[model samples]
Target: MILRDVSFAVAPGESLAIVGSSGSGKSTLLGLLAGLDVPTRGSVSLNGIDIFALDEDGRARLRGELAGFVFQSFQLLPALNALENVMLPLELAGAKDARQRAEHSLAQVGLSARSLHRPQHLSGGEQQRVALARAFVTRPRILFADEPTGNLDHATGAQVIELMLELNRAQGTTLILVTHDVALAGRCGRQLRLEAGSVVQ
Candidate 1:
């Protein structure tokens, strides 16, 4: 197992950071927490629901209804413009106002003028901001971010972090941030340290 006997809880609207060195399973833990991967043992509960108790499709349905994710790579589709990428989740959830909501989300990230730009056309920070807009557009109850600033320079990364925290507060959503930057980890309300697949602190 990549992680063993690692356990913790996050309160609603609370911010938590998981920090560790390379290959220490921080990303693995985040994936399990988000239900993107099932653990070999134990269980993960989201909003009081034991995700492990559900089948794959059921877990996916629940994830779609409750979670938002931001990754180090930004993960925006190259073919989709900022507006379209932000609208993808809302559209999948059958929201009739996906466009309007996506626009509002983009505006929140100060990316309104770049809404028509594709991923390749935007800068790194702008691309990440678009990814943020997409993640928040769903108004998810929880947000999972893994090394969200890994690909940005110092200043841009700080800006992204500030924006994420601002959105988390505004929406009253729980945040689980995974990163190696100690300063970044300190920005969270609480911190978890992992080492060799186990919780060390």
Candidate 2:
């Protein structure tokens, strides 16, 4: 099992960080919580709804409606420009104001000037900013970030972290992150330490 006897609760608008050494199941726990993966045992619930009780499509719909995600790889599509990439999720959700919201999100991440640039044309920091803009464009209630700063240098990563925290506070979004960076984990309202797939603290 990738995770065992791992349990925790996050209050609304709280920031919780999961920290673990390599191979300790930090990302696995994040995936399960996000409903991207189902646990072999136990269940995950969001807002009192047991997500695993729903069908796969139902879980996906729930994620689109209430959750956002950021990854270590910055997962932007190579074919889409910054603005278009940010607009994709909103468009998928059938929002009529996708373009406007995408613009505002890009501006929030200090990427307004690079709105027309594709992922490959941007620097690592700029690309990650675009990813952040995309994640927050929908104003999701919960944001899950897995090693969001792992691909950046120290300075750029710090900037990204600051931006995430600012947005989380401003929007009252519940923030859950998986990280190996102790300093980054320390900034959260609470931290859960894991060892060998189980909660150690």
Candidate 3:
């Protein structure tokens, strides 16, 4: 098992950092928390609902309603411009003003000028900013970030970190991030250290 006997609780509007070396099950734990993976045992609850008790479609619906995600790779569709990337989630959720909300979100990330540019045309930091805009556009109750700054240079990563924490505080979005950077983990309200698929702290 990639993860075993791991358990924890995150409060509403809290920021949590999960840290560990590679192969310590950080990503796997994230997937389970996000309801993107089903554990062979144990339960994960969100907003007082047990996610694993629901079917895949049910869990998906819950995610659509409450969750936003950022990834190390900046998981934007290459064909979609920054604005479009941000709009995708809002559109999926049947928002009537997806364009306006997306534009505002991109502006929040200081990417209005780059809104028309696709991922290929943007720098790594810009792409990640776009991803951030997309994640926050939904204004989700929970935000999951998996190595969100892993690909950026140190300076760029710091900028992204600042923006992320600022946004989290402003929106009261619960932040759950997996990272190897202790300094980054220290930014969270609490830190959960993992070792060999278990919580060591």
Candidate 4:
């Protein structure tokens, strides 16, 4: 499989939006950059480290150290409550105060009242808020969000977007967002247009 020779860079503390129609390879590009997926050709680098040169375990370590992700589908573990879902990563990272950190992060997303509620018990917007808490709990240097607002109504989506930008601003975390929404794309600081698996702009 060819990677189609696309190249781009996101500055630290910047927000870059990737926009295109469906099937335009926006998600693939994101996966490669975030080290979630590998490319057959070329390479990906983050913070001066070449990702493609790393073995799988090395890449996994890099992801844990550098990246956070939010998806359109709230990929929360069904059995875990909001707090538990947010605690998962912190625990995995061996943080001694995982529960405390998780609680704070959930509260940051305004889900403190629903901490005991499982994903199924929460509404769409609430579920996404839980996801947002989980994504930021690690305080990752970079975040990749794929259509984070795709599952919400317009008003709810706007609120979610606002929270995301707020966190990005406060933490100076680099953000790369993939979306088909033109209005959402405009809100980002930089825009990359993709077509046929290549950056067109």
TM-score of 2: 0.98
Query: What's the residue-level lDDT of 69 in candidate 3?
Result: 99
TM agreement with the true structure for every prediction: 0.98, 0.98, 0.98, 0.97
Which tens-of-lDDT digit does each residue in 60-101 have in candidate 3? 999999999999999999989999999999999999999999
Off by over 4 Å in 4: 1-3
lDDT of 4 by residue, 9-86 (tens): 789999999998888899988898988887767888898999989999999998999899999998999999999999
Q: Give the Cα RMSD of candidate 4.
A: 1.1
Candidate 1 Cα misplacement greater than 4 A, ranges:
none
Model 1 — TM-score against the truth?
0.98
CA lDDT for candidate 4: 0.91
The positional error of residue 170 in candidate 3, measured at the CA in angstroms, is 0.4
Residue 162 in candidate 2 has what lDDT?
93
| Predicted structure 3: lDDT | 0.94
